[model samples]
Every structure is written in C-alpha cells, then in structure tokens.
Target: MGDDHSAARPLRADARRNRERVLQIAQEALASDGLTISFDEIARRAGFGVGTVYRHFPTKEALFEAVLLGRIERFVADARALATAEDAGRAFFGWFARVVEQAAANQALCDMLDGGSQAGPQVGLRPGSTLADDFGAALGRLLARAQRAGAVRADLTGRDVHDLLRGCLTAERRSLARGGAVRMAEVFCDGMRARTY
Candidate 1:
C-alpha cells in the first residue's frame, strides 16, 4: 500500500515546473492576445511541445480557468497584505488603484473576473466559493480599517468600492492606450476620503 501511494503521489518536480511555466506563458498570451490565443501558440512561446500543454490542461477552457483562478488568488493575497499596512487609507486606495491599473493593462483578466467569458461554466467558480469569500473578506477588512481611521466615508460598503472600480474599467475602455482608468481611480479615491472642511 505504501508503494502504491508513492506511485500515485503528486506531479514530479520537472512536471510541476513545466506546468507552472505553461501557466505563466498562458497568462502572458491571454493578456496580450486575449482568449483567442491558441494552446499551440502558448506551447510555442513556452518552448514546450503541444502535447505537454495538453497534459497540463486538457482543454482550452481548462487553461483559461486556471489562468483566471491564479490571477484572483494573487489579487486576494495582495488585498490581505494591504490589510496590515500602517496607513489604512493609503493601503486601501493604493491597492484599489493597482487593481484598476492591472485591469486596464489586461482586459482579458478583467473580463474573466467579471464573468464575461463564455468559459465561465468550465471555470467552475460559483458565488459562494472560498476564493470569492476570501477576496470579499480582505476587501471588507481594508474598507473597515479605512473608515475607522476616518480616511474614508462611513457610509460606503464593499459593493460600492467594487462598483467604483468597475467605473474605472469603463473609463479604460473609452480611453484605451491613455490609461484613463488610473486617473479615474485617483479621483475616486479623493472622493472617498473624509472631508474635514
């Protein structure tokens, strides 16, 4: 039984490395070329055979899901890191701006997060998933901290913050190549701040 369990263990080191490499290349391709980027192109860019790509992600949808999930996980981690920042307001606004900038730079990633992909079903993410919960929790903590510090309005909720970020994306689409989203984020942050006068 011990030998059988060992044989059925997780991927070998090389295989794990290959999988990670493939995912990285897939993210780049998706960011630059959108969802239309083929698996063959990803394999080519990664310097791996098409078969290897297939071994890692059996279908195109699976690859898309993996890339989207990885991005969300990273965003959640960033939010968590900001939760302990010395200046709650700066951390909240800075992270908010960074997320908007990332969305502007990578439309594909933004679309995936918004569930605009036809491959949504394949991604298997649902409303109550742990990923969503963790992301929400992190954002909630940041917003609460900012509010308690009197850096942000007490009336705002996490949903309001999300809507504000979505507005940034809309601005980005209208002014592609000009980075309007980042500017919009700055203005939004200013409005969210408490006004003493």
Candidate 2:
C-alpha cells in the first residue's frame, strides 16, 4: 500500500483560513440551530463552497466535535479564572450561573446534554471522556474550594453539582417562562449552600 503523504503535510494558508471560517460559522449555527444545521447552510454562511467545508470537516459530527471542544476549552478557562477569586462561593456560583445561562441559550449544548445531537445518537458527550473529564475537573475544583470555605454543603460532591447543573439546563429548555434558567440556577445554588444550625 502506498503511504499517504498528504496527511503529513500541513494545511496551506488558504486552507487553514477556510477551515477557521467554517468552524466559526458552524459554531454560530450550532449555538442557534443545535445540530440540525446542515453543512450546506454552514458553507453558505461562511461564504465558501460546500466542497471546502466538506474537505475541512468531512462529516457533521467532526465539525460539531471541533466546535464543542473549543466551547469546552473556553468554559474550562473561565472556571479556572474564577477559581482564583476572593470569595470562593461567589466565584463558584457565579461561574455556575454564567454557564447555565450560556448553555440555555446555546442549543447545541442543550441538545448534547439531553442526549446526543440530531446528527446521531452516538454524538453525545459521554462520562469519563476527555472533554467531560476536563470540564468536570475544573468544576470540581470550584466546588471543593467553595465547600472548604463553608459556602457549599459538605455533603455535596462534584458529581452532585454536575447533576444539579444538568437538571437546571434541562428545566430551562422545557420551561415556557422567560429567564427560567436564571431562576433555576438561583434556587439550586441557594439549596446547595451550607446550613448552620
């Protein structure tokens, strides 16, 4: 079998630019349309040809994965930055509120948490995966710090915080009322607070 030299070569400058453009378009589409947005639409929005989009991201799942990874990285960075704040509890809850609001607005995140994307059942973020682990670890550090500061309940673990956030996101998706996500997060955070007898 002949070796594939193309895989070893870096993308041309134009191709790199095209790939970034496609990713940006795809991210916006995914935020608004979830995974239902088609590659044709993405290409049109990016001012590029369908072939260029396909050449860069071969499949819809591949494109979504790239977009999702970038989003996760952003969230992780935000969490890390907030972890250094003076008020541990406030920092944790603030990050939580921010994430919930963003997630509620982002259809792709809501869809992924609900299960898989519209593309396929297997496109969802699974537990123990690298992306999931990274996100969880960052959130866990905040939770632990808050607990140590007597902000959050001592009984709660990182998994519990994760579940609570997921519930808030799901509720926000189903609720008919506006600002439902903010309300849910507020209530959840209040309930998670440490109790003094």
Candidate 3:
C-alpha cells in the first residue's frame, strides 16, 4: 500500500486569507439557503472555483461542519457572557430563544447530525462526533456557568438543547410548509421558561 503524503502542507498567509474568505462566503450562503446552498454558489460568491472549496473542504459536509462549529462556539461564548445578565431566567430564555430562531430559519441544520453520519464522504461529521462534540464541549462550559448562576434549570443537560432545537426546527419546517410562523416561536419560548413555584 502506498503511504498517504497529501496531508503535509506548508501553511501560507495568502492561502489562509483565501480559505477565510471561502469560509465567510460559505457561511452566508448556508445561512441564507440552509442545506439547499450549493457548493457552486459558495465558490462563485468566494471568487474561487469549486476546486478551491474542495481543496479546503473535500466534501460539502466538511465545510458545513466548520460553519456549524463556528455557530456553536459563538453561541456558547455569548451564553457565557450573559451568565450575569440582569435577569438570570431572562438570560437563559433569551439565549434559548436565539437558538430557536436560528433553527426556525435553518431547518436543515437539524439534519446536520444525521446527514453527517450517513454514507458519504461527509459522514465524518456525525452529530455524536467531532462537530457535535465541539458544540457539546462549548455548551458544557456554558451550562455549568448558567446553572451556577441560577439562569437555567439544574436538571437540564446540553443534549437537551440539541433535542429541543431539533424539535423546534421540525416544527418550524412544518409551519413554514403551511405558510405559518404565527405564535410558534411564542409557544417554544414559553416552554423554555421555568415554572414559577
């Protein structure tokens, strides 16, 4: 068997710039079009050929995994920042609401876990794997902080957030399919709020 030598690359600043631009453009395209965004569009917007995208990310799922990791990191960072928010419950609920909104807009992100795990070059991105783990790790830090601050409920786990987002995304997809987004967010947000004892 021949040894794989393709992993070696002398990092260059200019190359890094191009890759960053590609990531930014790809992120926007995915945000706007969800899973429907094509690699061709991402390449066009980034002023690069599909080859550049493939070079940076061999598969669409790899590129998607990167974008999602960014979202998860930023989301948790924001939650950490809000740990001392004026109202603890409000902080938790508001952060949850932000997540719900993202899921509402990008229902395809829900399939991210399952899709990444399917039979494809992108299967490396399984939700219980790297990309999802990145989100989970970030969430672990935030959840501990939020719980200590009495922001979120004590019994909730990070997986709960993932599960809840999945449900919300499913509901949002059905609602949009029916041309209705009315009170859906309200009901979801209400459910996130803690009960008054």
Reference-based TM-score of each model:
0.86, 0.85, 0.70
Better of 1 and 2 by lDDT: 2
Mark the 10 consecutive residues where model 3 has the least summed lDDT. Answer: 1-10
Backbone clashes for every candidate come to: 0, 0, 0
Per-model C-alpha lDDT, please?
0.81, 0.81, 0.67
Score candidate 3 by TM-score against the native. 0.70
lDDT over C-alpha atoms for residue 27 of model 3: 74
Q: Residues 1-197, candidate 2, lDDT per residue (tens digit)?
A: 23466653455766888899999999899877878889999999999989999998888989997887787678889998988789999999999888887887776776565445443665666777787787889999999999999999999988898889888887766662454325677887889999987
Cα lDDT of candidate 3 equals: 0.67
- On lDDT, the candidate that comes out on top is 2
Error of 2 at 86 (Å): 1.5
- Using TM-score as the measure, which candidate wins? 1
Considering TM-score, which of the candidate structures 1 and 2 is the better prediction for this target? 1
Candidate 1 lDDT by residue in tens digits, 1-197: 99887875655777999999999999888888987899899999999999999998999988877887888888889999999899999999888888877876677666655555433555633457898677778889999999999999999998787767767766765677764434777777898888878
lDDT for model 2, please: 0.81
Clashes of 1: 0
